[model samples]
Target: MQLVFEVCEVADGNPVSTVRKVFDGVGGVIGRGSGCDWVIHDPSRLLSSHHGLVGCREGRYFLTDISSNGIGMAGSCERLRKGQARLIEDGDVFELGALSIRARLMEPVQPFGEQPVITGVPIPDDAFLALDPLQALDLEHQRQSTSDELEALSAGVGEPGAWADRHAADREQVAMPRRVEPANELPRVDSGALASPSDDVFWMEFAAALGLDLGKLDHVARKALAIKVARLFRLEVERLQHNRAYEEQVRLISTLHSDYPG
Candidate 1:
C-alpha cells in the first residue's frame, strides 16, 4: 500500500509542513519518543514521546493510541483512548497535541505473487495536481534528476536551492523572493498570464510557492533545478488550459439550451 503524509501546519519547529513523504513500508511509528520511527521534536508538554503506533497488517492499515494526553481528530473533538486501534481511512486528520498531521491511503496493495503489468494509460495533468503539492514537486524532481545545465528558463526551478530541504550555502545567487512562509497557503495565480510555460517569472513564482528562493541560489545551483521548475510550470499550464476549455464548453452548452430549447 502507498501511504502519504502531508504536514499541513507546523505550530512549532522547522517548517516541515512544506514536506510530503510517501512510504510503502509495512509499519512505522509516529511519536516524539527516542525509539519511535517518526520522531517529532516539539516543545509541547502535552505530547507523549510515544504517542502513536502505525502498522499495516491483515491486508489493512491501522493506528493505535499510546499516549496519555490522547490524540484528537480534527473534525471530531473525540480523543482516542490509550490502546485504541482504528482503521486508517483516506484523508484522516490527527492532532498530536500541538503537531497536526494528515494521513492518506494513496494506493491499495496489489496481491502478492501476481505479476504487475503496465497498461500504458495516459494520465492527465490534473491527476498529478490532486497529489500534495510537495509530493508533486518531488516527483517532478525525480523525473528531472539527471537534467544538466538549463537551455531555457522554463527548463528549471528545482534542484537543491530554495525548495530543497537541504541547500548548499555557497552556490551562486539567483535568489528569488521569499513569497511563501509555511508552504500550505498557496498564493492566487493568474494562469492565463503563465501560458508561455517557459517564462522566468512563472518559474520564479512557482519556486517561491515550493519554498525555494531563486535569487538565493548561485548561478550554478540555479542551473541545477531548471528542468523541475519547467515541468511544474508545464503541468500547471495544462491544468489551467483544461479548466478554461471545460468552462467554455459549459457556457456554450448553456447558451444552446436557452436558444434551441432542446
Candidate 2:
C-alpha cells in the first residue's frame, strides 16, 4: 500500500511551494528538521524539529502528532496533542508549523511511478566468429591460450578467500570507499553530529531505529528506504543549520535520540 502527502507552504491564505511524497508500508516523518520526509521550513519557529508522523495501519491511514506545539486538524476545534493519533481520510487537510498538508490514499498498483523502457541493439548471429574459416581457427586458438593462462593463474592464487586474506594489508593501503567518514566531517552537535550522507554507521542507526533489517531487503526495498533516510538527514541538517546555538543543537540531537525506542 502507498500513501501520498501533498505539502504546500501557506502564506497569507495562499499556497506557495508544494512538495509531494509517496510513502510506502511504514510511512514517514514530518518535521522542520532535516531528517523528516515532509520537511516544513518554519521561520516562525512554531514547529518542533520532529513534529508528526503519517502512517498506514491495517489499510487505515492515521496521523500522529509528536510535536511540542501540537497539530491542528481541519474543522477540528482543538489541536491534536503529543502522542495523540487519529485516523485520517483522503483529502484531509492538516496544519503543521507554518505549512499545510493534504493527505491522499493510493492503491498499491504502480505506486512508485512508471519505469523507463530500455532498448538495446540486438547481437547478430556469428558476431563472435571471424568471417573466414582460417581466421576463426586462429581466433579459437587464441581464446584457448588465454583460458589456459587464466586457469594457471587461478591455481597459483589458491582459494579466493585465502587470496583475499593475503592481500588484506594491500587493500587497506588503498583509499576508503566514499561512504562513512569520521564524525569530525559532519556538522558539530556537541560531542557528535548526525552522520553525513553515505555514512554506514548513521544508516545502520536509522535502520535499527525503524526496526528494519536492511540485509534482508532487496534492491528496490533498499532504494526506497535510502530515499526516506535521505529526507530525514536533510531535515536534521536543516534544524542544525537553522539553530546556531550550541546548547540548542545538542538538545535537538538528545531529543531525537531519546525519542527513538531502539
**If scored against the real structure, what TM-score would every candidate get?**
0.38, 0.43
Q: Which lDDT tens digits does candidate 2 get at residues 133-209? A: 77667655755777776766654342234445666788799997697656756654632234346555655676655
Q: Which ten residues in a row have the lowest lDDT in candidate 2?
A: 187-196
lDDT of 2 at 262: 69
Model 1 agreement with the true structure over 56-175: per-residue lDDT tens digits: 654456777867578888888677766767777888888887767888886655688676876886744443334577977776786677455442444445333333422344344658
TM-score of 2: 0.43
The residue ranges of model 1 lying beyond 4 angstroms of the native Cα positions read: 12-23, 108-262
Off by over 4 Å in 2: 8-18, 108-262
